[model samples]
Target: MITVITFNPSIDTLYKLETFEIGKVQRAGDVKKSAGGKGINVARVLNQLGHSPMCMGFVGGYNGLYIKDEIKKIGLRDEFIKIDGETRVCLNIIDKNKVSTEILESGPIVEENDMIKFERHLENILEETKILVASGSLPKGLPIDYYGLLGEICRIKNIKFILDTSGKYLESAINSHIYMIKPNIDELEALCKCNINNKEDAIKEAYKLLRYNIENICISMGKDGMILVNKDSIYEIKIPNIKIENTVGSGDSSIAGFAYGLLNDYSLKDCLRLSNACGMSNAMNIKTGFIDVNEIEKLFKEIEVLEYSKI
Candidate 1:
């Protein structure tokens, strides 16, 4: 079974407005809310694809309960650790032209005891989990090495670990030698400590991670698709261009797709194909990770994969 760990979960409130004026009273045309966080988004997409993923994370207070109810409404399984502090709410305001301005909260502070409870929850789930995905930011008061610790545990338990995060957490996870990592161009550049100007540069930087023991590396470049690098090979994959309704959670969806492919024993190329398709499909909807299987199937045929080798 697939298990996702979100250190910080939230209620994502999205608003649509004809125009956004800073420091002024503005009216929204439409509003929507949902359970959010990178790992939770992954679980939601995996569930849509007919896979039941158990979402594990810290949640508390009224907002936390709302998040849990929202997850259940979407038909996704969850096992959240109850904390004392209230959960956070993120705001996404989209203007008439589809330009999104996001305001993210720092989230509630997690006490040491809260962390312990979450670890215990994770420990119990790890026993039956085949794929363990740790994503998004760490909540306040939690150590930055949280993902790293989880990755190590997964390694010791022989579970396939997929990490999606940024900054120190991501760096720590890389050091732990997790099974796979999905970082966008910006995150990749930050991790590699160098500017990636082209595919050649990306491939060069990706090789550096291989020496660090990262089994598989996927660098997602938005519309340019993604580049996959492993010990044996490197490949470039592209998705057919499409109208993008929202880019949020595209990376999370891609991670879910890749994990799904790995779970189904798909080749790396096929895995990337599905990954790109899932991302593109998510882009066609306003909500994060909201996708249609029929759309994914149609887009799957349009993805192209090209293999590359060190020159």
Candidate 2:
């Protein structure tokens, strides 16, 4: 079974407006809410694609209950640790031009007891998990080594682990020698503290992670597609052109595709192709936690994979 862990979860409220007038009375044409967090989004996409991923994370208060109820309504299985403080609510305003403006609140503080409950939940889920994906930001009061520790636990339990996060959490997880990591160009640049101008540069930076004994690395470049680096070869995938309605949760979808492929024993190239397809498919939707399986299959064929010598 695939398991996804999100330390910071939220109820994502999306508002659509024909025109977002600043400092004026603006009315929304449409409003929707979804259970959101990077890992939860991944699990949602995986569930839509016929994979029932177990979502494990921290949730609390009324907002947290809403998140749990929404997850159940979507028919996804989850085991979240309840905390004292309320989970956050994130606002995404979509303008007429299809651009999204986000106002995200910092998540509630998780006390030591909350951390203990989370660890217990993680331990229980790891027993049957074949693939574990740790995604998103760490909540306040949690150490940066949170993901790193989870990565270590996965390694010890002999489960393949995929990490999708940024900043110190991702930095620490890199040192934990995860099985795979999917970081966009910006996140990669931030990790290596340098510019990744092209596929070659990305491959170069990805190779550095090999020193940490990480098995595979995927660098996603929006519109430009993605690059996959491993010990044997580098695969450059170019996604077919499509009109993008939204970019939110695309990365999480990509991680879901990759994890799903791995869990199903797909070849590395096929996994990367499917990952890119899922990302592009999510881009066609205007809402988070939304995916079109038919679009994913169509885009799957449109993805071209180029193999290169490992730098």
Candidate 3:
């Protein structure tokens, strides 16, 4: 089973309006809400793609209950630890031109005792988990090393750990034995402390992190597709362009697709194709992490993977 860790989960409100003007009140004809955060998004996509993924993290207050209820409503298991602080709510505003703007909360402040309880809970879950995907930012009052601690647990237990986060948490956690990581250019730059000017630069930078024991590095480049870097081979995946409804959760969906392909023992080329397909499919979706199997199947055939010289 796949277990996803979201240190700071939330209810995501997406407003699609005709146009968003600063210092002006605008009306939105459509609005949607869902349980979100990178890990949870991964879990949702994993589940949609025929995988068993249970979500675990810290939650609190009425908003937290709503998050749990929403997860239940979707038929996924919720194993979140209850905390004292209220969970966060994030907003994404998109105009008719497809321009996206975000307003995110810092999330709850987790206490020391809460951390202990969560670790104990995660330990039990780890026993049944074949892979652990930890993503998102550290909540207030939680040390940056929190994700690293979980990575250590996965390392000790021999669980395949896939991490998608950035900044200090990612820096600290990369030192642990990680199976894979999905980083956009910004995240890749943050880890390597340099600019990713192009695909070759991304490949070079991704290799730098492999020294940290990270087996696979999936570099997402938005509309430009992605680059898959590992010790064995380097693959560049490109997705067929289509109308994009929302780019939110596309990266998480890509991670889920890649993990799913690995679980099925697909080849690197096929895995990269599947990952890009999932990401592109999510772009056509209104709700984050939602995808139709038919869309995925059709997209799988359209994705192109070009392998470069191995390292």
Candidate 4:
């Protein structure tokens, strides 16, 4: 089983409107609310794909309970750390055109001692873990290097670690013994300290990440597909694009697909295929982090993985 960690989970409210006008009251036609966090999003997708994922994170107050219930409602096996502060709530407003606007909240405040307790909780579950995924932002009072510490523990336990975060959190964990990471192209550019204007630069810069001891790096470009970087081989994966209902959680879906691939010991080429297929299928539906098995099967057949050339 894969383990997912969400430092700051929330209640995500998606409001659908015909059109949103500035300074005017808008009525939503349909509204949906559920658990929202980078890691939690991946967990939901994993459950949908018939995988058992154990989710761990911080939640408190009534909203926290609501988040827990929503996780169970979606059939995600979960174990959350209860805190004193109320969990956050985030808003996503989608217009008829499928354009989305978001309002996000910073989640519960966690004391330093509480972080220790979380690590202890993690200890009890590590034996069941095949891969450990820690995603999203750092909660209040928790150190940025917390993810790095997680990497350290995973290394000692011989479990693969996959990190998907940004800024200081990414910086701190970049040098850890991570099995893989799914940083979008922009994040990739920043990490490599150079702009990736073409395929050559994309491959070259991605290889630079291996210097930090990262075993694999997947840089996803929305329409251009994704680039895979490794020590022995490099490949570029491109897929047919479909009309996008919503782009939210597509990245998380890709992460879950890749993790699922690694857990099953699929070849790198096959893993990239699964990742691209899952990501593309997510855009085919209105629900975030969701995919139609039929959509995934069709897209999986259309994926093309090519060797790169500097020429």
Candidate 4, residues 196-264, lDDT tens digits: the string is 888778778877788988988888889899988888777889888688888888999988888888888
For each candidate in turn, the TM-score is 0.97, 0.97, 0.97, 0.96
* Candidate 2 lDDT for residue 218: 86
Superposition TM-score, candidate 1 onto the true structure: 0.97
Error of 4 at 70 (Å): 1.4
Candidate 2, after superposition: displacement of residue 156 in Å?
A: 1.0
Which residue pairs collide in model 4, if any? none
Q: Candidate 3, which ten residues in sequence have the lowest lDDT sum?
A: 144-153
lDDT of 1 by residue, 1-311 (tens): 89988879888888999999999999888898889988888998898888988988889899999989989888778799888889999889998888999999989999998888887777888888999988899999888787888778888999999999988889876778588888888999999899889988988898889987789888888888888898888888977779988888889998989889988899888888988899889989988768889998998888999987754
Per-residue CA lDDT of model 3 for 1-311, tens digit only, reads 88888889989999999989899988889989898988888888988988868899999999999999988887778999999899999999998888899899999899999988987888788889888888889998888887778778888999999989988888888888899888899998988999878888999999888888889998899998998888888888877888999898888898898888877889888988888888889899888887778999999998889888787
Candidate 4 local lDDT, residue 246: 83
Give the 10-residue window scoring lowest on summed lDDT in candidate 2.
168-177
- CA lDDT, every model vs. true structure: 0.87, 0.88, 0.88, 0.86
TM-score of 3: 0.97
Clashing pairs in 3: none
- Evaluated against the true structure, the overall lDDT of model 1 is 0.87
lDDT of 2: 0.88
**lDDT, candidate 3, residue 112?**
93
lDDT tens readout by residue for model 2, 183-251:
888899999999878877888999998888789888889999988888988898998899988899999
Cα miss at 263, model 1 (Å)? 1.3
Candidate 2 residue-wise lDDT at 14: 91
